[model samples]
Target: MSIWQDQHVTVVVSGGIASYKAIYLVRQLMKQGATVRVTMTAHATEFVTPLTFQTLTQQPVFSDEFTMQDPKHVGHVALADWTDLMIMVPATANLIAKVANGIADDAATTTILATTAPKYVVPAMNSHMYANPATQRNLAQLQTDGLQVLTPATGMLAEGYVGRGRMPEPDEIVDWLTQTLIDQQTDLPLHGKKVLVTAGGTREMIDPVRYISNRSSGKMGYAMATVARELGAEVTLISTPTALTQPAGVQYIEVLSAAELLTQVTAKFATTDMLVMAAAVSDYRPVKAVDQKIKKQPGQTGLTLELTETADILKQLAAQKTGQFVIGFAAETQHLLANAEKKLAEKKLDMLVANDVSQPGVGFNGDTNQVTLLTPNSTPVTTNLLSKTEIAHSVLTAAINRGA
Candidate 1:
């Protein structure tokens, strides 16, 4: 399930040109399955109407404490009580000052004051205003009051000046909020654990212009990295060439070849609590890479190149394993379980994820996969055809159950 499923999110929009952006943020939250209610400052309504937010959230937007739309209970207090998480997007300089000084003249401030739920403040203003001593002091005070404040992005502001104080993009805000919520769950299965994941297909250089690579799109590995982070593990993704975005809050290291992948994994193995080797490392590389691109002769009929074996990363990791739980992937076309089991035992892996690439929608370059989880002395658990994200959570759950 999505982390935001059934979550009650209260978005408090304050006055700023960035208030329009908050509409997009609210839309994203609802898309993630959050039941969102919006509270707008009177000035905020000038930027975006309450009717817009009310229509989008399918709930009444609270702007005044005296307004009695829900006659039975106080609107601000009721909303505050129902909120699981509260966020102030485009937290203007005035709102920050009011909040810091315990001022609650408006519905938004009143609800903020009433809620015991964790609060996240996203600041947005002119660069000079944000950098002012009073603003900085109030922000620091908010942190001291136990509120989480996201730093404003450094870029062009609404005033046509380029500097700090641009509100972060909607997607980035969602990612940050997601990570914050996940980190707050100390009881998550992988909490306090450090996970290292390798992703994408390694490229083996043959010449300046040519190389050997595989069809891996890195979707599965990227899913694993994202899920691991959501499970509260400190995740590091060592990746090869792929067109995927780096998962938020993950440490990303990009490498070019099997040799680089092996070196990076080896360096980090001892400190990691779990290792997921999902990358498709090239098994062979050209014996000697040409300094320049090999020219195609006009009359050439055939070309020959010598190849040599690349380092066996899994084997090397297995030999170096101390207390870390290691998981390996086997993408096979035949005898999938048998081959995966052999590798699991031979490489001392704690678990193995096996999938048949030949099957449609099962593996390699796809968003969906059907995988079998194999562990020492445990019955193989096969999952239904599911998205890579679902498969990632399943794999992590199995790993945790196996004492990873």
Candidate 2:
């Protein structure tokens, strides 16, 4: 959702057994929200057909400079101009040598020469071929030319021996690309800051099996974490068990009970710039938890368990906060604003989000949410029913506007 989203990525495929790996690379890029298009050398078709890549990207593959399908625009030049980022995968020795010396004979090399966008070169071939003096000189020249190049893996080759010059695994390549893109984006709003987010309903166990929790599905917290990440913050998501898939590029920590959640959040709070406490912490827990499951009495009509107050995580953490911007959530069935206002002032929170969970399509295990935003000495602002993602954006935008 950061650099890869809506990006115009051009993949240049050259000849090698590693050409097949490019397929997975394209798929991964698309998964990261990129608009991908592929260009291939004529020889690359022998290994992977153009139709394969065509079907994968749902865009025409460019392999020949001579083919003029569009009357108004030259093929390679148009592709070059359309590209925001270019990748050369399985860059064979022939292509590398040509690119090093500025030879533009085919569609792939011609587009590479014409495009002003950043180029990433991934070389794969025989170990001896990669070790040749000419190849070494060309590789160095590529670095000197300001292109990002990945060192090939030292592993088993198609020739059935272990050595260098194997293309890196597809997933590894995608990870490298993702990190590189994030590093390059210095102007992102939360670029250098750390954000801590807690999600889900904390469980307070009474026995081995029975526990106290809530209807919180962690959807709101997950959305907050994901949106914070998309805003370019180094996000840490501390969550209770849920069915949600963890967002990419964010650090994750797991906790089951309120005590564990408190420990993790407090441990990371010192370095955090902003904290969003979205998890529904249990108000009371069993006073004594037995190791084994509690059994029902033979003649008993009901069961009674002693309960005690759980730790006040938000109030404790916020009371000691120095420069950190702390945000807390309150779910009330009645007197939403009055109750929320009391807590907001008592906890000394920079922002408080209050919602009435009794409404439909709003809060607790649902994809949609409606909330009232409160800041110290300011009027409360209410939001219409919206998807959790939209609510997340609104909340973060308000925080940023308030200089959080």
Q: Count the backbone clashes (under 3 Å) in each candidate.
A: 0, 0
**Tens digit per residue, CA lDDT, model 1, 1-404:** 66799999999999999999999999999998899999989999999999999999999899989999889999999999999999999999999999999999999999999999999999999999999999999999999999999999999888887989999999999999999888788988889999999999999988998999999999999999999998889999999979999899899999999999989999999999999999999999999999998999999999999999999899888778889999999999999888989998998888899999999999988889999999999999999999999999999988998888
Error of 1 at 113 (Å): 1.4
lDDT score of model 2? 0.92
The alpha-carbon deviation from the true structure for residue 12 of candidate 2, after best TM-score superposition, in angstroms, is 2.9
lDDT for model 1, please: 0.94
Native RMSD of candidate 2 (Å): 4.1
Scanning candidate 2 in windows of ten residues, the lowest lDDT window is: 174-183
Candidates' lDDT values, in order?
Answer: 0.94, 0.92
What local lDDT does model 2 show for residue 341?
99
